[model samples]
Target chain A: MTQEKPTVVLLTADGVPEPADLAEVRDLTDVRVCTAGTLADTLPGAEILLVWDIFSGALSDAWHAADSLRWIHVAAAGVDALLFDELRESDVLVTNARGVFDGPIAEYVLACVLAHDKRLHETEAFQRAGQWRHRETIRVAGRRALVVGTGGIGRATARLLRAVGMDVRGAGRRERDDDEDFGHVVDSADLAAHLREVDHLVMVAPLTEATRGMLGAPELAALPDGAHVINVGRGELVDQDALTAELATGRLSAHLDVVVVEPLPVGDPLWTLEGAHISPHMSGDVEGWRDTLSAQFLTHLRTWLGGDEPAPAVDKGRGYVSG
Target chain B: MTQEKPTVVLLTADGVPEPADLAEVRDLTDVRVCTAGTLADTLPGAEILLVWDIFSGALSDAWHAADSLRWIHVAAAGVDALLFDELRESDVLVTNARGVFDGPIAEYVLACVLAHDKRLHETEAFQRAGQWRHRETIRVAGRRALVVGTGGIGRATARLLRAVGMDVRGAGRRERDDDEDFGHVVDSADLAAHLREVDHLVMVAPLTEATRGMLGAPELAALPDGAHVINVGRGELVDQDALTAELATGRLSAHLDVVVVEPLPVGDPLWTLEGAHISPHMSGDVEGWRDTLSAQFLTHLRTWLGGDEPAPAVDKGRGYVSG
Candidate 1:
């Protein structure tokens, strides 16, 4: 006799997978798709939850209704959105889509670094004006880069930077010996000191209590003048006002893929900042991203149903994968 | 007990070093700086010629006046400016500033590839317009690139592109086995076949009968649709009309640092082509480049004065340093 299928709740928002795309998961589970408005109504008695709408706060708002929820799989690398007090204290397991974004995000970070050093923006402006002004461009080799965060994305970024002949250093929660890509992995407490030496500062750390607002006034001040800041991680990891002030004075440059507010207000000062390269928060996104996310969730679901531990299990207390 | 120093004529244009900057070379030779109008007057008796003005056609115009000229050192990489039949048939040894631009040009090529793949131009446009449009970007890693030319600049470009995770193949005068950076090396005759497989085609070959007008309509048509063309070699190496036509139809894109009529006429269709990223011929220029050129020439001058063959002796027949 076949075992009975368990209830699987899929929380979705714009650009995520449709019910038809999740037919693979539906074959093994009783799938119920929910939007922000219907999440609370469908959360009760669900054994599994796929947080496809990572930006939605519905999961936290309806946490009390998750009486039968045993596992939560986020369709993103970050778990900050689902790391509530109740979930942190519960026995429910959390898994994230980790490996899918490493290569694409790392490529994006390197692209920003190259564009800034090569003065591509100025070149484009000259092209548009039909002016020919020749200028010297900086070399990427032998430059120093400090990657904040030692996760998959951070390691990938460090590797690519190093491959292009850069001296790369990484920072994690605690101090460790050199890894394959980074020369040394220092403790987060020493980020300020490292900031002074690097030409580029890349923020790829997760959004947690210890990291939110990490690059406020003092930390931003520690960076050498003319240093570029690249943030592909959470928006709240930096203080927007302080960053704006620094950029306005032309003391520092920034390539921000995320801002404190998504769909940044039309009137925000960042849009007009000469030193900023702002893009909508889509750094890790590549073609067929939705299909990739759905496939990753299905792999985890198959393992979870077979009573085997799924890979990339996140530590609720630590807010990331431990190893 | 002392011998008379050789007369060294310095040809200069816009960004070339001034007489004061050539003091080191002056200490070893009787230095005579000349512009276009004065070049004919100074060319008669000079034993050495420093072609700082690579864009000037003065060398070819006054070749008959070079009675005592034994050697010519060009301040630029390409020797197209000096490749007159009279010089090619004469005994004057030619040398060029070869190593100086290898790294800078390679970095520029990689920068353009990254900018194109990451859609940085679109991102900047969105930032300027204060529009928050989220779009998926292309990843650079594992993409194919065809780097034309097997010389220092082409080799350097292949290395940097490969370092960024590209599957790089190089095309030269003839086919060869895989080198350190390029996985396969094809002959220029087979470039059309290779063009169909690559996402990026970087042209860094020197201007010569073998390479001039290489990327004409037939070759451009062979490239995969949406493939990006990067030209840093010389303007004449590509057919501008063919490239502009392809770009107009949105079938291909280009990052041209060199153009047929640079300071590309204000009304040129290329400037208005949405797919073209046009810039002045400044791919190899960097800060303190003039100083670097002077130093390189000084080093070569010292070797020439000692009667030992100065390094980087160019083969007049081939128009570049041959192994």
Candidate 2:
């Protein structure tokens, strides 16, 4: 007697899980691809859901139809988009593409830190106008960095920064002494005190009730003058208005890869803020990222098929992976 | 019996030797501060000359006036300005501020590498225009780098790049196996072959008979498409016209901290090149650099005054420190 293969519904947007990527998991599971519009119709008999479009609200909109869904894998490091009341109350296991983003995001953080210190933007402007101006740049070595979060991405970022001679301090949910990269780990509650001494404040924390709006006017005010804020974490982690105000006054600078609202509206003042370097939420995306995401999900599929639990399971209540 | 102090001539431009810096050496020698216009008058009785204006041609023009000059120290890494026939032929010892520039220039080179790979310039433009554009950036880690010159600056640059996980190779006047930072060290003659395989071709070699105009059309053409040329060495090391032509066609890019004619004439096409990042010749200068330069020279002064030879003595023929 042959065992039936589980049906996996790939919910995507703008053609994610391209044909080649879908082929990786197609042999093991009966697969169906659907968009936000057709997700409800496709979710009826699927026991597994690959939420490739983590930005879409279709997962919550179509939760009633996911009667057979036992597991949900978000093709993103953060799973905030899929934590609706019904999904949170259900007994479904949720996992995210954690390790895939660690290296690329760490690289992006370093790039931003170095760029801010060197004033590359000013150099480029001078180049464009045929003007030659000499300016002294700050040294990155021996500078202080505070990485807010101690997860895989945060640890990876801390290690890269430390490798280049930065004095890195990490802030997480609780203090831990076993970390190799962070010179010191402190409770997230003590972040404000640490902010005053850091030259670079890197945000790589997951979005949760406790972390959301963590960096507001008070936190921004506590940072030392000329400190650069680099956010690769979710947008809500920082208060956009407070950041803009600080940037406008030139008291602080920021390299924001993600914002509270992405595709940040055309008129958003944060875009034109004097020291703000904005990118449209693509820090972790390296070449052929779609393939990597598919491969990550395939690894979990294989583990689940062999009667083993898929790793990096998120705590639905906390909205992140907990120890 | 009283010992007469040596007369030291300090040649400067634009107020370089600030009063505080001059005070460091004033009590040790009979010091005469002069500019390019007044250098000839001051050179007549000086036993030591501090060439603070490394870019000035005054040293060559006023060489005939030097009657007692025994030692000439240039407050710069390169000694090209004082490499005149008269100075080279005389028994005058020439030394440079070599170790002083190595660390700062290396940091600048790393900054350029990170900025170029991350396209920070483009991100800035997008930010200025209030456009939220998301683009995938190339990873610097595991990328190949060919640093030309194995001296202090080049070795420091190689170390920083390697720290960031780059595969770094060093090219010097001769092959060496003892370098810890470089994976392989090759002769400068083989640079063209290596350029084709590297992502960053960093020029940190001193200006010398063998290295001047080294990176011309043929050498630039040998580099793989999209390779960046970072020159903290000297302006003449690269052929400006050839580099400009390559940058104009968008096949190559460059971050030139030094140019053949610096304070690069306002109308040079190199300034407007599509992928050019230009800064005036101040890459090695950080905060309190003048003070540091003065201190470095003072250290050597005490050694020379005590009848000991000052270090980092340049070989007149090769124009750099010889082991």
Using lDDT as the measure, the top candidate is 1
Q: Which of the CAPRI classes, incorrect, acceptable, medium or high, describes model 2?
A: medium
What TM-score, to 2 decimals, does candidate 2 have? 0.97
TM-score, per-candidate, Cα-based: 0.97, 0.97
lDDT of 1 by residue, B12-71 (tens): 876555834576777788989888778889998899998888788788888878899999
lDDT for model 2: 0.86
Q: What C-alpha RMSD does candidate 2 show over the true interface residues after superposing them?
A: 1.5
Model 2 DockQ reads: 0.74
Native contacts recovered by candidate 2, as a share? Answer: 0.82
What are the runs in model 1 whose C-alpha is more than 4 Å off? A19-21, B19-21
Candidate 2 chain A lowest-lDDT run of ten: A15-24
Error of 1 at A215 (Å): 0.8
Q: What are the TM values for chain B, all candidates?
A: 0.97, 0.97
lDDT of 2 by residue, A47-161 (tens): 9998888797788888889989999999889988778888888999999988888888998999888887777777777777766777787777888999998889999999999
CA displacement after TM-score superposition, residue B192 of candidate 2 (Å): 1.7
